[model samples]
Target: AYTVRESTVFYVRVPAPHARFATDLLCEVVGQPRLDPADVEIERGVILGELDGALDTPDDVVFMNLVEALFPGHPIGRETLGDPQSLVAMAAADIAGFHDRWYRPQNLVFAAAGALDHDEIAKTIDAHFDGRASGVRPERIAPGEALGSDKSAQRPIEQAYLALGWRGLTATDPDKVALAVLNHAFGDGPSSRLHEEIRERRGLAYEVSSSAASNLDAGTQTVYCATAPEHLDKVRRIIDEQIEAIVTDGIDDEELAVAQGYLTGSMLMALEDSSSRMSRLGSAVLTHGRAIPIFESLESIAKVTTDDVKRVAERIFGQQHVESIVSPDGDEFDDDDED
Candidate 1:
């Protein structure tokens, strides 16, 4: 499977015995893909179908609307799956050109995890990938300043979907670890402030969470909730209150410890899978320019203090946010609507 975000990743899982074969196959696909015109036509229809499905998904629509508001005329704001017009207009040559421009030896990183010899794998990669001219890395254009905005759409769905977005730190920012901790305590899990206050205590929402998506140059912090239309106002109010409290008072020591432990444990558990380990290795090198040891990552989380969390909260949550909502009523719930 392949995924596209700030970076594009293509991966496959196979038995340990076929590791070399998998490596060769991956190299062939990445380094020299034949963008056949007939195949492109077929895949275009597949992507269009995917686009229709995404549009029908309330969660996808709401989050994408939030991103559009956050980035506006930028490429980051556009749907990853090209829109209907773009999909129809795109040709095999367009795809081939894109592949040639971006898929360079210097811009790629090969990573593997399993019972494999490092030297043997390295030699195989060199044999397949060496001798190509090291191409220049493309310079990235950062998105401009984002202003706060609100958007709403009506859907036939029973429950309302809402998303709140704010501009966030870059992947390499010094404060990323603190932001992670804040995310965990704020809305990541059942113990998070959002889940506890909005779902467990108030019963205003069935699902509520927050996430941070950091890229090479830009990032986003978002909070999402699905709730009844009548409860939308209360849910928004509770989210605002939580943000204000965290920004003003910061998280306490116990909350800090819990968030830290949760992050560390989650990391350890995820690394147990060879695929996850391979992803970590590749993504770390691609994003940070080197592989960061697990211990180093854990230590960074451990060093995050209450002040760190509060400081990051103020930096992110204190800013104006973009809001997107999809509901039966295509309008924001008024404060007066709340009993």
Candidate 2:
């Protein structure tokens, strides 16, 4: 048996519930999905086509290349849409091996929230998957080191899209709540430092933000910005200056209070809907082995002080990070021209 979660945010203006929860009943589809070899080959071709399409977009190319450099040999770093060449060359056996290794029942968890009963789910799981133990728990692979600051390509576009990353906490890390709050204060939304500094005050390009890419075993946090090629140096300096400021000065009490309030409020608002709640519950169960109660998680965020944020900043930004610059491929740009 398996569970699929559809976590969606329902706007107040929409007719959908704040959150909706539905649990699927799957008895026969317990292990690796069964697809005919012909179908698999067809799907593989489709994936390869999509990868080609993505390569046509400069932004997508930079993003994918950054990930490739960051994760190296790790699956997380692996192309979400398999490498077109490798995928096209894959034998049927390769796909089957990947499935057998990652699709075991023990390696998966079935969960649902937002209008579902635990008892019914337990019964369904018992009926379908309990008795037929696959008897194998595949060990998950670890992610590789963060990539260095080398820019792989130079493009002739007017604007440069830079993707910078830092090694971040794993999904199960106890510091996740603190890191979430820190991220909010730094670059999550409009009120974040990256936005306020890069957009509102300085009037650079219109986008700047940071995000956490967390998985069961590991996570990464990245800050991204887009600016005219002429202003790339300014943008890079601003980012570095901000990181330095955070690490040394830390946030004041008022800033801390504000970040805490916004993060906690956002968390509460997110869970107010059925779909969002279901997603939260499902993700927690699948990733952390149990659902983290929303209230408790918020309380943890509330406890984060400026010191914690600074400490995290120091640890994260101190590492070798990846930088991807998207411009015309033939452009000859002096990467070290930054003042």
Candidate 3:
């Protein structure tokens, strides 16, 4: 679930022989989601429980808080999991309205993997979704502002969770490739600077990782970690020191090669399966309006240089950074709010 997907996708897989059934089933589900009043009521309860669960999870709360601070009033700030109040007020009509807005063929990308006849699949798709898929592209009801701020809240949790975020480059931007390289060397995996220094060396956190997320209009560069309430400041300082090193000294040749290899191998591993490839292509089209060739992606990562990474690091980390932390019963961050 913690993957690159934007929305909750509905996908069904079957053997090549049963591909037609899967196709037909998808069409039916999309065209009609079984929003019966009684079913809606039951699912509303289910969703509310999920939202409550998210609220109780310190990591989820802090991540959402960081997002809200980074992009206040934006759609991305809203928790994808429906909130309690909204779920209580929701009705079948609301679901229907959602379907009306974005379910059109123009806004959809149909991707499949495995062995199948292209012509036959086309015929089956036409038979099922031909003129039934309708509607024009929806226009923006509101625009997004990548405003940054510092925010924190107290909860009844054991450990303190913190998220450091910055305004990031969009997927289409040329700087994103270098940013990805920088992020990998910074905290993408156990071998990253943050993991090696914060968790393995200092034992300051149980969970520590950084990510570079690219959205439609903007992106988010973030580092998240959970630690003992008293250790939050130390962990933050360690992270800041690592960022400073990246921006100042820049990664050496060996580090650059390793980072590129890590990204390249990770990408190749993800695409080894058919479903992964389908999802990758489908999501790319959905997000950027076109699929980026795997070869092109690899080349971009390979071309990243130490200088390029330094430039990206300085540009990104130099932006307005929002630091959001959630502690169990601490007030240390209460008056530290700033942008």
State TM-scores per candidate: 0.95, 0.82, 0.92
lDDT of 2 by residue, 205-314 (tens): 78888887777666777888878777888988998988888778867788788888987788889967765776687678767668888777877987897888888877
> What is the RMSD, in Å, between candidate 1 and the native fold over all Cα?
3.6
Higher-scoring candidate on lDDT, 1 or 3: 1
Sorted by lDDT (best first), the order is 1, 3, 2
After superposition, the stretches of candidate 3 with alpha carbons farther than 4 Å from their true spots are: 1-8, 141-148, 330-339
How high is the lDDT of residue 222 in model 1?
A: 98
Error of 2 at 141 (Å): 4.6
Clashing pairs in 3: none
Clashes of each: 0, 11, 0
Which ranges of candidate 2 are over 4 A from the true structure? 1-34, 91-102, 141-149, 154-157, 333-339
Higher-scoring candidate on TM-score, 1 or 2: 1
Error in Å for residue 63 of model 1: 0.7
Report the lDDT tens digits of candidate 3 across residue range 1-339: 222324557787678899888888887787667778899999888778887888777788888878878878777666787567788998898888888778777766777778877677778767766876577876644335557567787777789888999888876788988988898889988888999999999999989999998866778899999999889889989999998998898788988999999989989998778788878877888777888899998999989999999999999998778888888766565633321
**Model 2 alpha-carbon miss at residue 170, Å:** 1.7
